[model samples]
Target: MTSQQHQRAAGKRAFITGAAGGLGSATARMLARQGAKVFLTDIDGDAVATVAADINRQAGEKVAWSAPQDVRDEANWERLLAEAALAMGGLSVLVNNAGIGSLGAIGAIELNEWRRVMGVNVESVMLGCKHAMAYLRDAQPASIVNISSLAAFKVDPDYTAYNTSKAAVAALTKSVAVECARQKIDVRCNSIHPAFIRTGIVKPFFDKLGEEEATRKLVRGIPMHRMGDPDDVAYAVLYLASDESRYVTAAELVIDGGARAV
Candidate 1:
């Protein structure tokens, strides 16, 4: 099929958090190219603006805008969603992609660290789903894609806080999905679980261990024998965001390169 014919998100309005880089930026660009009007938000206003400009330039259209958003704050979530809806005319896709990773065993993890991880990774998803429901429902055939991690299922000794928070995200996605279905909201919620994608999130590990050794160790665990690119997860997000996934909800799209399967 021709590229234009493959534009699955044509005419959709998408709002994505953490849009400054990594998986979030990739998803934004892909959706824009697929003919979606996208609102990109991140705590780093300048970075997100740069991403938006880049996407618009590449697409040769005014398909994207950027905003500064702090997803952990409920008030901010409400305000941002309203602004995003206004900017995009209405919202059909909500991508709760802003999150942070923490590395510490249970005994060594500080109370503040646990709380921080939970607030960003878990509570942000809750806030996004709760606040964005009205716009999504009104828009109809809407999708909410939360970015969880394979760490949710495959626990690591050093990632106690991260794993717990992401697991909560997965559970929360299902709960939201079922509630929307029962209420006939016409809004779908799902989570993406990615393992060892070459994003900024993994840079710390590479810095701690040598890059070569870190890459080797990470790849060794994957049955596919490779680390994933940001686009790998982005394509899954695209499928979930598009109307093609209308029958799909409360699903966990794992982009782990067979790491979990193994």
Candidate 2:
């Protein structure tokens, strides 16, 4: 089949966790625009509804749906998957994008903070894969695009907890791909590792540095000389979720604007 036909056939029903945030929301909109029926979700119930409503208002009916979900809770994962299947008739893509970011040195970070970050970032991806596997198995051709970070590869100090959680996501993505292949599940799993996307997490950090210094420091680090937009990461994710990346699995697609290399 032609590439356009492949993409059109493959990208259909997609559910995005953490759809209220920068990267997730952008990804949801991108997928919807590409003719996929998207489901948006977040821990914030109100924010989830607003995002879904806004996307639907702009995109029209059958374009989007929003639900409140705690990715750490397996039951919520199951419920959301069932709801998505009911709404869209089947599941073709799952974006495990829900995550919490924490900043601190390893020795200075509280144990509770470390656990909370891991619970949200690492466990949530695990739950998404676990609960969605059955439906994905039945669907045959499906993809799970996980949201990891550049920190998963290498990292500076003062982000110990966040770094560890993303590292786990990277590892988990590989493991999921291997297991699915072995089980003949006809599913693909991969992680997208991005660096310093202009998202809500950057606002407080920028506020601390007064924007100017923060911008300068970040631009200096990234060879692209600016913070990567969430749409950059979203498009990378949409590519993996679509048929364009059908041969790709257990891969880490890094959209860091050359930050990780430099």
Candidate closest to the true structure, highest lDDT: 1
Global lDDT of each model? 0.92, 0.86
Task: State the lDDT of candidate 2 residue by residue for 30-105, as single tens digits.
Answer: 7876778888889897997888887788766657888898888888888889999889888989999999889899
Residue 227 deviation, candidate 2, in Å?
0.8
Candidate 2 to truth, TM: 0.94
Candidate 2, residue 257: Cα displacement in angstroms equals: 1.5
Q: What alpha-carbon RMSD in Å does predicted model 2 have with respect to the real structure?
A: 2.5
Give the runs in model 1 whose Cα sits over 4 Å from its true position.
1-3
Taking all chains together, each candidate's TM-score versus the true structure is: 0.97, 0.94
- Evaluate model 2: give its lDDT: 0.86
Where does model 2 exceed 4 Å of error? 1-11
In Å, residue 168's CA in model 1 sits off its true spot by 0.3
**lDDT, model 1:** 0.92
